[model samples]
Target: MAVFSLMLVVFSLTTGEFVVSGILPDLAAGLGVPLSAAGLLTTAYAAGMIVGGPVVTLLTARVSRKPLIIGLVATSVLANAASAIAPGYAVLLVSRMLAGLVVATFFAVAIATAASTARPGKQASTVGKVVLGLNLGIVLGAPLGTFVGQHLGWRATFWSVAAAAALALLTVLRFVPDRPSATTGPVAGELRVFADRRVQLAIALTAVGNTGVLTVFTYLAPLLTEVGGFPPGAVPVLLLGYGAGAVLGNAVGGRLADRALLPSLAGLLATLVVVLGLAWLGGGHPVATVVSTVLLGALAFAIVPGMQTRVITAAGAAPTLAVAVNASGYQLAAAFAGWLGGQVVDSGAGLRAIYPVAAALTVAGLGIALYSLRRDRRESSAQGSLPGGRSRTS
Candidate 1:
């Protein structure tokens, strides 16, 4: 019940975050802005997350996890309500930014809480359950919200999110316990976890790797309609396929990561490179494009559990702050990728070019993963050897 409650909180948060993707056209048309300008909504939301994750984590370091979760959900409800009733583009952007801030804090705290609740050695699996909420939001919530937005109005979508969040808040308040953090250190002490080389590498890998996925995902609607020759109405269906793949990938990746973290990370990044490469080549054909979208979603999300587990383990005593920083890294990468994709579209390079760019980013991330893996093995070998060249444990 507790786990389910946490999932609902994450679901509501993620739906609010991603629902904009499906309704960008509606939002643009309603506001009388260009697509590029509407794209700024994504950028603004990510920028708020990038800035808010660490800041909120620092400020709330001493707060109990349960109340903090409740408060964040309440904030989300208000933000979405504001979004639903915003008078103009500027007002809507402000609402998104506020929502982003609360959502980032919610994820960092909620993931930490979920992981801490796990039985020994099953941390990734527990965390993955929470992440499943995120995938489910992508799978069920976003498309449903998109459908509502299309039929009613985009503002109606935010209203739906606000109501969902309100329900999640009640569930969380009732079911989830107040789990105190293991690290009771001051904010400065918690921040010091960034000094670890492994944690640092994990953050970089997360940012670079996630940028690959977001680069393509941020522009998927336009690519499908304009380049793949799909009707605009088909976008939700395609996203549903993509989201289903993400659900499978998230489950598999979490279990695999629990068994072999580094190998799982490297393998998933390699898969992303291949999937995006295929997407780049096959995006112009209808069937191929749909298949590639599903594959891309799966391969891209498969890296998340491993990467997140790596950061939590590497950070040792300061997992909360570490996870918050990692979330910030993802949003920073997403913000940059969103902006870059917009520029690519505006440059008249066409929608097909975005997939190749995404592939390149994944390749870069794969290189980092390999480098981190090698470093880990070398360190492990060094720790195992004794002063006289004997096995330390034996």
Candidate 2:
């Protein structure tokens, strides 16, 4: 129940973030702003999440979890409401950023809260369920918001998300329980984990591992229309398939992570490289493109839970700050993906070139994962040589 409530928060948050693209034309006309200016709303939200989540999380680390999430989600609800009623582009843009500010912090706390309730080894499975909300937002919430915007108005879409956020806040207040801090030392101490070589590597792995797949996804529409020979109309449907695969991958990935974190990540990254290559090679074939698209989504998301688990494991008792930073790293990688994809396209490489290029990047991530695993083994073997086989964190 608690985990589901958290999922609702993510669903609402992400819905608000993604629906901007759907309502871009309406929003531009409504606010008398250019469409390009309206598109900045998405960048604003990403900026808020990337910059605000970690700083806010660090500042509020001593607070109890339940009220903290409630506060953040409630703030998001109000921000969305503000967006719904905003009279100008500046107001709308700031409101979107406000709504985005809570995303990373909320996710970090929420994942930890959910994992705390999991039975022993099932932590990753629980985290996976929480992550399912994100994929669902891409699958259901964005489309629904877009429809509402088209039929009603762009402002109506914001209202819809505000309502969803309010509902999430209420349920979370009811279902989510307060958790005592796992480590009660000075909150600033958590910041030191960032300096640890293992922690840094884990965060880097997450950023690198996600970049390739996301770059492919960023250009998916063009890839489908130009390369796969699918009509523009089919793009949304294929995205739905991709989103569905993400949901399934989350389920399977979490279970695999719980069983073996590093090995599973290594295997998943290797597979993702292969799938991206397949996507590149078979993109012109309709059936092959469809199959490869779904597989890409699955393989890509299957790596997430394990990467997150790796961060938490490496952080030891200071996972919250580490997790927040890790999420920021992911957002940064996403920002980079768009730029990288744009660069590839502008270089006169055909749109089909995205897959192999992305695949090569995933290969780098795979190398990092294996290297991390090797270091883990070395540390474990060294621990076994000690008097009581004590584990090492740094």
Q: Which ten residues in a row have the lowest lDDT in candidate 2?
A: 385-394
Predicted model with the maximum TM-score: 2
lDDT, candidate 1, 1-394, per-residue tens: 7888888988988888888977999999998999988888877788778888889888888888887888888989999999999999999999899988876778878778878788887888788888899999988988789999999999999999999999988888788989875457666788778989999999998999789789988788898898888999898789889888898888888898989888888888888888787877777889999998888778777788888888888988888788888998887887788789988888998888898888888889888899999998887788667577655565
Measured on C-alpha atoms, candidate 2 has an lDDT of 0.89
Segments in model 2 whose C-alpha atoms lie over 4 Å from true places: 181-183, 391-394
lDDT of 2 at 59: 81
lDDT accuracy of residue 21 in candidate 2 = 90
TM-score versus the correct structure, for each prediction: 0.90, 0.97
Q: What local distance difference test score does each model get?
A: 0.86, 0.89
Alpha-carbon deviation at 286 in model 1, angstroms: 3.3
Which pairs clash inside model 1? none
Write the residue-wise lDDT of candidate 2 on 5-90 in tens digits: 99999899889888899889999999998999998999999999998767988888888888788889989989999999998899
TM-score of 1: 0.90
